[model samples]
Structures are given as structure tokens and as C-alpha cells.
Target: MPHLPDSVHVMTDDTRPHTATPTTEGVWSVRGTRITADRTPEGLRLRARAGAEGLSRIVLRWRLDTPEDARILGDAWERGYGDLQWRTLQPDRALPWYALITGGAFGGPTTGWGVRTRPGALCSWTVDESGIALWADVRSGSLPVLPGEREVDVATVVTAAGPTPFAAHEALCTAMSPDPLPAVGPLVGCNNWYYAYGRDFGPDAVLRDARTVVEYADGHPVRPYCVIDDGWTEGGGSAPGGPWDTGLPGVFDDMADLAARIAETGARPGLWFRPLLSRTETAAVRPGLLRDSGFPLDPSLDVALETVAEDVTRFRNWGYGLIKHDFSTYDVFGRFASHSPAELALPGWSLSDRSRTSAEILVRLYGTIAEAAGDAVVIGCNTVGHLSAGLVRVQRCGDDTSGRSWERTRRMGVNTLAFRLAQHDRFFTLDADCVPCTPRTDWRLNRRFLDLVARSGTALFVSVDPAARTDRTDADLAAAVRLALDGGTPGGVEPLDRLSTTAPRRWRSGAETLVHDWAEPWGAVPLAV
Candidate 1:
């Protein structure tokens, strides 16, 4: 047997003195939970469960022999969609291989943390780290386990083994995902938010973009898509509920017709909306619980869930083939990107229904959207990645990349693609975000970012501004579209420098190795006309 790290079980309930004794092969009985773990041919199989005492959290911590110089990598709780504070942990001040809990706080579940050693290892947790610590579920507030509950089944947390970090993550995601990977082809398309910024865009603007997609397609076997983001709302503004109508009167005029028009351009039509936040008009008709903002519908209520399903169903009926729902995590927790999942736990507050765990609530909500969406592909943004895993067909895995700042694009876009790229089809088709081709950004940098997106095998969304039409005309964009639609290089591309830098300059896509210095600005951003 290969030498293995000794597993040390750490539990919150220290007062109750307990002894762990190896009772069966690769299994130990500690406190009320069974600690079963072993090095398998694939990797390590680790699980903790309690049938009588009702398990909460059981962390199997292992220590490094030297702790001399150690580095750790922990994934962001949700993709960078909130306050824009959460960063990939590359602790500035080096520690003796031990770092503070950068993952979920003491009250929640930390999905996985790994040392910079190989074969690369990745751990996936069943419960949110928060629940095990403070008894607060990720979505729902802390709820005490009822007495005499039959059993507490904490999901299996697999510490996957692989020759590289990317491979380990791929396996970890595969182990964690509940739904089978979808047989989705390349979703190379254009989104309006980067250029429109939710300010002004309607039927004509969307149709024009859709036409660009068709022109860019250039007779590709796989069709392109045009997504009308944000500004299409009726009486646009944030409030709860909706007439849920499409576009303000005279803007899109008729949504069903608008969708047909985009399809006529040989492109699929997609729409982006904050499902929980609604206009005042929507609020009046289907009033339900409200979040801290006093406008966004509280997802904790049953009635609000019904409203959500109804609204999503309306979009499907309107002929939109894809629906991107954003900001539900922020709405439910009243916390944005700044707070980790652990920080969002509020023990005093309970949902309208306390029976369901936070994870359960989110699953139910996402599942509702999926069920109502019918055939329309659903993309979840500002959602918890672990919870959104199987529910959404596509997930915006990182924060928004900037059209105005090259640094922001590199930090947000390239970093996410490099680190979370392993989740490409496992959780959902990971979307690092659109390649913003606007005059405000440096095209040289944006073009490299676009190439990465096209070849990353993730969802490719290009937000082309009218001013940057020439920039989008570059042959690279079309070639990238071809590569993306063809499902990218086989053996799944991996970022070679993910652990070394926040923005990796090196990537290996099967046979070809691609390199780009994102920090090297090709030229200054052209002054806006």
C-alpha cells in the first residue's frame, strides 16, 4: 500500500468525549458518525454519516509533514458575481503550509481545499460548510435537527486523484454533480449586456446583433444565438412580480414576433432577466414575500416560487429558446459577492418554510425554473455553483469581465477560465462571460480573451458594440466560433499555469500549447468618438 496521509477527524461537539476505533476495513466509528475513508485506485473515498446522533459536519483534516513552504487553492464560494471582492486565494504572506480558513467560515461547509502537490487532489462536499458549523444551511437559516430523526446522510466528499490539478477538479466535479452531463453542442453566441449595459436595447438592436451572429456563422453547421440582455423589461426597473410582459410597449412591440425575427436571422433568441427582482407592476399582481431591498421577491416563500415558475413559463411561451436568470443568491441572502457563504448565514432569520434546507430551497427554485422552461436552455448567474450544478444547463461561472478595463477582463475573465475551466461540462457549461469587443477596451487584449473563450470549450458569448464592428470582423473571431462550435480540442483543454498565477498566460489544448501575455497591452484604448 502506498504511504497515505493520516486522517484526523475534527468535530464541533468537543464536549462529548468520543473515541474513534477502526471497526471495519477502511471505516472508523467516531461519535455517532461513521468515518469511512480509503485510498482507492481512482483516489480517496471519504464519507461521514450519523444514523442516531444526526450528523452535521465532520472534517477529516490532514497535515503536511514539513509545513515549511506550502500553498493552498480554494475556489470562490460563488463565481465573482457580487461585491467583486472574493479573489482566488494566493495568500500574500506565506505561512508554514497552513492558511486561515479562506473557504467557508466556521459555521458553514467548505467544499474542498488542496495543497500545491500532486497527483492533484480535489475534494467535493455534500453539505454547505456553513450548515455543519453554525447549523445554518447555505440557503435556509440554521435549523436544529429534530430528535429521533432516522438518520443524517451527509453527501460523499471525494478527494479525487489525478496527475494534475485540472484532472482532479474534473473528477471532483463529476463526483459531485447529480445530473448527468448534457449532450450540449457549442453555444457560440452574442450577448448584449457588455455593450448595452442594460441601458438601451430593444427588438431592432437585438435583431441587428442576431444578424451579426448569422454573418459570423458564415454557413457553420452549428447555428449561432443572440441574447437580449436586461433592458427588455416592461416598465423596466427592479421590483417584485410582473405582468412579466416582454419589452416596454413599442420597443419590442411583440416579443413572440421579436423572437421569430431573431430566428429568421438564423440565430436562436435568448433573454436575460433578474427573475427575483421585478417591476412594480409585477409586484401588484403577484405580491409575495420581499427581500431586504423591499422589491425583489423573497424566494423563501411558496407563493414567490409559484410566481417564478409562472414568469419563466411566460418566457418559454414567448418563444425565447434560452433564459438567463441572475441574482437569486444575492436576493435570497441579501448579500452580494463580498460575503462568503459562511458570512451570509443568519440564524435569527428563518424562511417562510423552515422545513427545507438552503440547498434544498435553491434546488427547488432552480428545478422550478428548469421545469417551467421546458425546452429552453437555462443559464444561472450570481448563483451558488455547487447548488446550481445540475439545475442549470449553463452557469455564468465568474464575475463580469470589463469592456472598459483590460485588467478587469484579465482578472475576472481569464482567471476564471483558467481555474474553473475544469467544471466546463460537469456542473454546467461554464460561461466565463462575453468577450467584450468595444472601443473602450484594448482589442489586442480582448482578441486574445476571445480566442481563449472560443477554444476553451465553454460557452462563447461575444458582446459586440456597434462602434467595435470592425474589431469583431477579425478572422480570429470566426475561427474561434468554428473551434468553439466544434467542441474545442479533445482530451479537454487545461490551464497549465492556474496554480502559479491568477491570470495564466499558458494553456495546453490537447496537441497545441497556447500562450498569451494578458498583462502586455498591445496598444492604448482608442478614444471614444
Candidate 2:
């Protein structure tokens, strides 16, 4: 264990010098990361910075001691992701580097920061030191054993070189600096291809026909963000052979006309793009981007990404208000052999080097999109969560559930609920998997799912084609939208049955609201408001 120094934890006796290995259960040591922790008989509560921290720069914040102890616990090792960046914290200003209630530890049924497979008991932390400026209290007997609440503790670790705790705390404190920009009400937007890219069959006739949804959205109480999916790559024309060039002429011209119409409907125009993806299906994909075959093409390279900066600018100026950048993770992993199981897969590139490069690619792509679009709202897709963290304001809280909207909605609903509950504080909004809840089966069930998702955090997206659904269903849809507009608490799932991943007993979606039982996957038990 090497002496790590970054404030990455909170509460309790400081353990700054404790070092951590990049491997899941390796030793963790740090400087003065504030661990805002809650304790239980099992372990301490921990929450890592969602957008803020990757494993690269995190170290447990503890009061430093003799170099003798540090040398004994420290090895000159640098594990994966990012290389080490260290700075000694003058014993006065504790290693507080973030504004998040970082990570923690706990026993059964709690989020795992670390655990041992062999012992099966919460690993006892080796206390290196305790000195000036400690805020944790001593547990006389034991921490209160609350029924529903997991006995967890919190810690704020310095997960990275940028965004210090004081910096974040100050930003949050000063967030309300007088009258700000227009409160961009969460727009009810829909990017057409989510139900299945219309591009597969060569721009289905229906994609061109989706104008009606945009036309209808214009009449809603709030302005909507409607996006034209993949087919209309309006201005990539400069790259004549680029995918954007082949689209129908006057696409933007017609869309500009539609924009005026949408303006009347009080809707904003947004466009969908598989930013990192240029299908051979579409010509935008440069030959170098695709695998000589397909599916397993590498996604970490610049060539694979088609990042034509000017093209993005054209879209922004073209009057598109929001941009959905999709599919950076074209391959799940660069597994060497086909059908390689978990046992066979190797880390793509150098595990040490590639992960950081993967992270770099993410920031660049997102930063590029953000810069290119100015203030246009950006939503990242298929970008494994950690990569898109804080850089993106809104994210697909759940996976993209397109053609199989129902099943995708259900699974994505569960995933986004838990993920958002875990990361709600990271960003302002959660793109709950899009819902097309109708009067059909599980309609009310689906309605409840959407309401729960939005109530917790700002939710953006809509799949109902009001013109298509019945009048009554439309009323319900509107009410759901209204509640979403109003907002509600985020959700968390507490396991009732003994530790099992199959499902949790009491699944709660809000702060102190209601909890539903998903014991048997599809059991829909009703709850009253």
C-alpha cells in the first residue's frame, strides 16, 4: 500500500494514508478526502462521485503521520485508469476535493465499495492516524439499526485532479446568483428512431412521416423538444459522400418551415445523432471507422468517431435546439475471441492505458459536442455511465428502449430508478427510459413507472403520439407529463428478502414517498396516493 493523498471519503477517524489497489478489493488509502459516512454494525456508508470520480485519482483522506508508517503501508505501485497525481495537503486544509457524499461500506444488502469474498465479513479498516480537524463521532455501543435504512457511512474522496470539494461546495452555494437564464422547462422531446432506427430498411417511409408528431407536440401546454431522427443529416453536405449529404434536399429547408410551425406550437427542434456511429448503412461512416466486417469495430479511435467539428456547428446553426449524441460504445468490449465469456475477455488495449484513453475519448467527444452546439442540451447514449458523468447534464437514466419500448421501458425503468437514486446529485436530470404507456396492458403500471422516475429528478422525453392514443389515454398521458413537469423524489431499492440480486422486496421510488414490492418480477401491486 502506497500513501495516497486525495480527499475521497467522509466522516469517522481519518484514514488518508491507507492505500488502495485498483483491483476491486485492494487496499484503499488516501489523504484528506471527506468521508461523509453513516455507520452500522455491518460497515460504513459510501457513495462515489457519479460524474466526478473515476478510480484514477481517488485516495482516502486521513491525517498524515510519520513517513515510517506511510512507507510500511505504501508500495510504489500505480494501478489502472489514470496515473497518480499527488500533492501534500498542509495539515490545516483537510483534503476536501468534492461536493458529493462520496462512497461508503456496509454489510448485507447495501451498495458495495469493498468486500472480501473469502472472509464474508466487512473488512476491518486499518486505522493509520487521527489528529487535528476530525468530525466523526465514536459509536458507544453500535449504530442505530433502522429497519429500511441500510447501515451505511459516507466519505468524500478526491476522485480526480479537477473539481475540488471546496470548489463544488462554493458553486452549489452560489448556484442561485440572482435572476438567471430562462428556466429551460424540461422539454417533452422524442428522437424518432428510438423505437428502432428507421435506417435499417433504408429510411422507412414512416420517418419522413413523423412530422405529425412534431406538429401535434406544438399544441402542448409547455414547449416540446422534438427531434428528427437519423435519416435527415441536413448539412453534412460539405462532405458530399458524408451521410448527411444523401438526405432529401430541402430537409432543413422543410424543417426550417417546420421550425416556424413548431415555434407556433411552442416546441423546440432537437435532432438525433449516433455521433460515434456512422453506419456503413449510411455513407457518413468513413471506411476507416468500420471493422472490415462490423459489430466489433473499435470505438476508442478518432477515425472510428467521425468527429467533423464543422458538421456539428452546422447542426446547431441549422436551428436544432437539442442534440442526442449516441453510440460511442459500438463494441461491448474488445474481447479477443468471439463469444468469449467473462473468463476469457481481456481489457482492450492496456488496462492501465486504455481505460484512461476511453475516459479521454468520452470527455473530448462530449466537450466537442458541447462546444460545437453552444448551449444546446446534450444527451449521451450507450456511453457507459461513468464515462458520461458530470460532463453531460442529462443522460439516459436507463438504456435506450426503442422498438421494444415496453420491455425496454420496464427493465430500463428499474435500472434508471436505481441508477438515478445512486447518482441523482451528479447531474440535474435523468432521462428516464422513454415511456409510451398506453391504455394497453400494464398501462397504469407503466404510468406509475414514469411518474416514479420523473418525480425523483428532472425527467425529459415522451413517446406517446397523442394523435394515435385514445382521448382518455391522452388525458392520463397529459397528467403524467404534468406531474413530471412538477417533479418528485428519487428512488432507492431496499432488499427485503435475504441478499439476492433477482429482486428487492420494498422498491421505493421517492425520498419518503411509497415503496412497491417487485418480489416476483411482474407483480403489479397497487398503491394509493
Global lDDT of model 2:
0.38
Per-residue CA lDDT of model 2 for 263-375, tens digit only, reads: 44455676666554333443333233344233222333454344445556666766767776654543322222111121112322321123222334444555666677778
Instruction: Give the Å shift of residue 482 in candidate 1.
Output: 2.5
Error of 1 at 408 (Å): 1.8
Cα deviation at 6, candidate 2, in Å, is 14
TM-score for all predictions? 0.77, 0.54
For each candidate, the alpha-carbon lDDT, in order, equals 0.62, 0.38
lDDT at 313 for candidate 1?
A: 85
* Model 1 CA lDDT for position 298: 57
Tell me the deviation in Å of residue 205 in model 1: 0.5
